[model samples]
Target: MMMRSSPFWPLFSQGIRHRVLPRSSLLTPRRTVKTLPSFSLENKTCVVTGSARGLGKEFLTAFALSGARGACIDLSQKDCEASIASIASQVQNAYPDDPVPELRAYECNATIESDVKSTWAKVVEDFGKVDVLVTAAGIVDNVEAENYEYARWRKMLDINIEQGHFVLAEEGREMLTWHNIQGSIILIASMSATICVRPQKQAAYNTSKGAVQMLAKSLATEWGPRGIRVNSLSPGYMKTDLIKGLLENEGKELVGSWERDIPMGRMAEPHELRGTIVWMASKFPTKPVNPA
Candidate 1:
């Protein structure tokens, strides 16, 4: 940032220097804060579910931008194709020379036990070992609690809750047995795990997130000693594609309430969550590894 002499600065400083005015009498120039450069995530193989669009797509891009080999997984092969093409194009433009990323698409219904097992087995086969797993794929539907269909409720629970468990369990087993080092498992949790979602009734979604919170802590404790770390992130809403329409429809007041609830004054952007995800995935850079 270039600093320029303000038209009034010399006059104001002259006043202060001559003891005619206090230093606070004039506005001071503010220095621009420099942003920290991104670190290398090269050689890390990460699996991000629901990479076809929205939050998932953002996560996939972030992983690639950070120099990691990424696997983009979603239910539809067509969606994955579009996602892969988009990511490839974006990375190629960004990096140009070192642009060809080791990213592939996979289709798996995370809710099914058999599907998770096969999908993870293939993930390991292709990537060698899973260093980081970002479980971003999920669905949300809001309906009056009393009139909520049982099938819909069950579907929410199975996909959001059971599916997370299956993926973690499958990957955890491999990381513990096949791999010699610890790995990280990050669950894309929501503030609903602690705070209640008002106005609309999403009892099923809330409950599923609540269950994930426990699952994360339990797995962390169980695997901590074995060099594997587990943690969950509960992010407030951001301007993701899924919620963009709602925010525009419901107006900013509905989103602004979260600022009142949390210390931050607004919802988190998808990439804003990236720092925490990477930190939790890898061991802390400055801190020594826990031998326990």
Candidate 2:
């Protein structure tokens, strides 16, 4: 049995009512000071995995074009050298007067955590800091689910899911935190994460990309408070080394099927993603400070 409260108990006679205003009424107009940062990589240092060829090469070239120094990390030092040379020539030709930013190449197996760490350490020592990281090392297998070997599936998981989703995200975050730099991390996911390609059953590839998408979301949430922005870019079919096989083979019917679904009705060229890479590396526009 509970005892009754006295009549003099200090309860609010107004009943603690809240005045709920209409949504539109609550939106009062105010003056704001907006600071819009330029989408330029003027003084940034960018680290690009799989920078030997294909999409990685495009990213390296794009960053160089935007005035950013680049570190090309790939399995083959020779290929990395070629990529760096090409980027230097392109930048020199594009900006005849402007000094070309320094570009270095490192032989790194992105799937190996130790290799990645040492390579990043070398980069930081050489460049002072890394303002952006692009994880573009990945592979695709077109084997059917039933016929796909366990070893190949493991390889896919290791290269795609583990390297970008785990290794790069963690190591890059650590580097950013240590340098107190608000760095940008860009992971390459594929549109296959959304729609499965017909006539080609790459179950392993599709699942790995789906995992990469989720990994980006999770890393973004965890690192947002720390000023590190993690994002995933999902391009549809691109005319890169990864898809050369399908494009060259008797995939006319499959290509038609994909084209019909795409609004662009065509595969993207690797260089077309340059603008996006620049935008990602730049600081986002500041939130306006509203005046009363």
Worst 10 residues of 2 by lDDT: 1-10
Which ranges in model 2 have alpha carbons more than 4 Å from their true place? 1-37, 285-292
- Residue 105, model 1, lDDT: 71
Alpha-carbon shift of residue 14 in model 2 (angstroms): 78
| Stretches of model 1 off by over 4 angstroms after superposition | 1-39, 245-265, 285-292
1-292 in candidate 2: lDDT tens per residue?
1111111113322332111111122112221223244666767888888888999899989988776778887887667877887887887787666566777777777777777666666667656788888889899888878998899999999999877754565555565567777778888888887778777789999999989888877877777567877788887788898788756764688778778877889878999998777777677622211110
Q: Per-residue lDDT for 1-292 in model 1, tens only? A: 1111111113333222110111221222221223233344556777888778877787777766666677777787567767867876787687665534567677788887888887776667656788888788877767778988999999988888888888888888898888865766777778788877766577888888888788877887888778777777777677777787666666767776656765667667776766656655555633222110
TM-score of each: 0.78, 0.82
Give lDDT: candidate 2, residue 238: 85
lDDT of 2: 0.72
Q: CA lDDT, every prediction?
A: 0.68, 0.72
